[model samples]
Target: MCSDFEPLGKSSLFTILDACKASTRKSLQGINYFAAEAGEAFDGIRKMIEDKVALHNDSARLIENLKRARFYLKSDYKVHVARSSNIADHCCVYALSDPEKRDFAQDCDHEHNESCAECSNLTRTLNEIERLLEETEEDEELLHRTLKKFRSYREAIEAWKAHLLRSINQDLCRENLLDKLSNDEIYLNLDWAMKFLPIKSREPQSEFFGKRGI
Candidate 1:
């Protein structure tokens, strides 16, 4: 008895093609936006655009592979639904024969398997495109935050440097007082006077005494 399995439908092939077109369009749109906004965060946006472009290229290649597969199925496998209904009628009969072959044949039905595979590919590609787009947006936000932090740090360092300069000048006043003291006066209270003078905290190496500039 001829199997009663249905051949792949034209609708299934068209659906895959449509999905490919949609995926390509979405990726292209994302890439274009990323490129246009490159100046916003040049490195981040450029990387995102490159990722999207790569994904688009991959999807295009997959579509070409599917097209080749379809051609082979139609020409070699005699699986064209429109040209010969025998493929479908045979599948239907086979489905009623041995239970294992019935299940296997059903699983291999081109319409079902091909459509499922195409849909899966489309979903995966769409998700990747969206993720890359989001990364660009997040990177821009990070750059803005970093700039604000840098400006705040710069202002704080300037203020700290000014305070340090004033403290160094105060040491000069102490030096003048020491010069004025007679030998007897200096000897009379040398330990007490030494305690009052501001001593340098180690030798000045860099700004903030070799500590963090901020």
Candidate 2:
């Protein structure tokens, strides 16, 4: 009833990205309401308002990107890792072995010299994919850390707002910049994990235990 070679999953990347765009646009509307009333008189207040708006926008954007990437890492990139690892990697392993005795699947044409385009392409593709995945791993870690900081800073921001509201001058238009966040109480340590990674087999290592040994 179904085809043998089906796509791994539906392409929901565009749908997720569209939702991100819509939400980001809606959030920016908050900044428009607080535009400086008297131009130069309340520049500091305006700057603070814009900064708060920017933080919200930037945080939302980073979270959306992470979300989208996480989806791809689970779906599309997972498929890519599965497919790219099959024939080419087997051929590569064969090639690295004895040139004369080595054998690969007949269709796996890694027998060509390094100058061959097909050979070069397959070689570079795996390397580049691993490199890119490593970088993505680092980036995702940083994004997670930023999210934690935003959570911790929420309390500081709320306290700052409450204190400022009680001041004789509640208008922000006249301020230059809000004070830097000093409260670093909330700390989060995230366990790092790679959402997109090669599905390497443990069989090779497991075979060692099967051998006759003490």
As a whole number from 0 to 100, the lDDT of residue 17 in candidate 2 is 63
lDDT value for candidate 1? 0.38
- Candidate 2 stretches greater than 4 Å from native: 1-54, 82-214
Encode model 1's per-residue lDDT on 1-214: one tens digit a residue. 5599776799998988788775431212222222223222323322434545444555455445434433432243222222112333223232223565654433433432222333234334334534544444456775465445433433443333233333434454577788898867862334421112223322222222323322
lDDT string for model 2 (1-214, tens) is 5668764344676776667775432221112211111111123222322344334434344334334433432244323321112433222333234445535222343343224333234234323433433444446775465445433333332332223232313222223223432485443446543232222222222232333322
lDDT of 2 at 15: 70
Candidate that scores best on TM-score: 1
Off by over 4 Å in 1: 1-144, 187-214
Clash pairs, model 2 backbone: 42-173, 42-174, 43-173, 44-175, 44-176, 45-172, 45-175
